[model samples]
Target: MSVCDPSALARSLLAWYDRAGRALPWRKKGNERPDPYHVWLSEVMLQQTTVAAVTPYFLRFIERWPTIAQLATAPTDDVMHAWAGLGYYARARNLHACAKMVAQWRGGQFPDDEEALRKLPGVGDYTAAAITAIAFGKRAVVVDGNVERVMARLFAVTEPLPAAKGRLKALAAHLTPDMRPGDYAQAVMDLGATICSPRNPACGICPWMNECQGRRQGIEAQLPAKLAKPERPTRHGIAYWTARKDGAVLIRRRPPQGLLGGMMEIPSTPWRDDTPWDMAELAAHQPVAAQWRPLPGLVRHTFTHFHLELRLVAGKASANATPLGLWVALDKLSDHALPSVMVKVVKHALAKAY
Candidate 1:
């Protein structure tokens, strides 16, 4: 019954988890161990993305490539296409790389130990810890944002985040129980997500309500304070909607590195903090030379750290015109891996067509 005792705290949380844990696509039921492939895929998709956003993508990925070996053998472009709308395109690339590594060298079996798992592509401390505990049933500290918030409120830790991260992880490590460590880890995350929310928490029904010091102090909502983040800078670019006479659009694969890597994109000038694109620069980057007219509206999309403004221009390819990239038929665009931003460009261009 002692809240300060890690074993007792874990026991209380696990009991709640047994009744209230989320029925996610990857989560296994009672006495059924989690699949490491599902665990890895779901965790990767969940990064910088919400559960609502990731659910369909996870389902699609699993449906298409059910196993790690299948995913590794699948074409990287296909993976990127399937992962188009999911931001952080680099994760998709690393996912394919990791899958290939695991399939080829590890004999398609994910490593159970934290140290061994950490060596895999895109598997960092948090991911390695999560895989070790949730998939392998090993005792490992899992300190995701949800866990950090839960710890901060449970113990009334007052230091701001980033600086407070170390302390929070230490507390989470302490509470990480040897018994049912996997369930305990997920239970804490579920508690944070469903009950100890960042806004109005449902502490009345929280299993740890009586143990919560932040609630006693009347600041559980504000417990895990954070330093203010700097404003996201706005970047400007131009999206050229180059349509071939055959109703195909010119799209190119992004460079292997950098933002939106390995995804298909409408031909565009470099996205920069510089001014709205000058018409003269079109000669350098435009897919083909033709009469270019400005589209009616601009496409605005936000990345994690920046705001993007894209002006669209339309031009048709002549019979002799040979563009630099692949010309995908308009209706078949869905088959290609256009990032969300390029999807906007296509929509904007199509709006002008009708």
Candidate 2:
């Protein structure tokens, strides 16, 4: 019940972690300290993404910038461009802003504690805890989805996550050791990722296999249940593939906020849930009586919040572009900050047009 007297379960888990932990690049050896910048960047990139998915991004980012100071001074366009396929563009924006703040305001050092770390843009509870523990060797309990699943299964927690999440966090806090806080955090994450997996867990090799409540109860695979998500709603829109007589294509920069913010894309009519107006209905929405021709297919994309069906329309324009976008040279399209979906749309258009 108290922090000093950790449960038998907690002791067992940490002991196993002491010997069986994996050696990751960002991790410090034995008594060495970890880099705050590396910890912070890795944590941010890992959000809503798997370790496998984030590894390459982490390598690419560090290769390009190498240090927090370099990242701080890098241009926003370059940062956004490097982060093109990373899905969450907002994180990229916040990472750029926070890097500059730390470099200029904090003397190129990440704050040593949770409060200062949390004050930075995009650093929330999980991020702050991770940075504090890993970067500064502070004793902070880091609870991410991996930790949540690990704790939930260990305690036979059946309340279904989001509801069970609070108690699971409390349990994890009790288990977190003061010594090797950074290693301990990574250990638990590794345990969850490799051993206590969501599907087909390798329980026999797990450190806590003997004490795990879910394993004891023979429900390791189903401990952390949750309400099923509603079927994602679908919407329809029209993407205009305007091209010059030459090979240039029309593209625009999205506004600096919502989904795919700050990325470039082919001009598109509004996306909506109600059936997209046919060619006639689209003309009503356009300000000018421009000529439009529908492409043979629809480009489908799924966002975290919604599913999108974009009707592709190809048209020709003079060097005089319509209000939304500029005519971009086809061969040099890679330079633009395009979302993966937009990239797909552009590639599809170019393949057919040229």
Give each model a TM-score.
Answer: 0.97, 0.93
Show how many residue pairs clash in every candidate, following the order shown: 0, 0
TM-score of 2: 0.93
230-251, model 2: which lDDT tens digit per residue? 8888898888887677877777
Give the TM-score (vs. native) of candidate 1: 0.97
Model 1 RMSD, rounded to 1 decimal: 1.3
Residues 126-184, candidate 1: write the lDDT tens digits. Answer: 89998899999999999899999999999999999989999999989888889987888
The lDDT of each candidate is 0.89, 0.83
**TM-score: which candidate is best?**
1
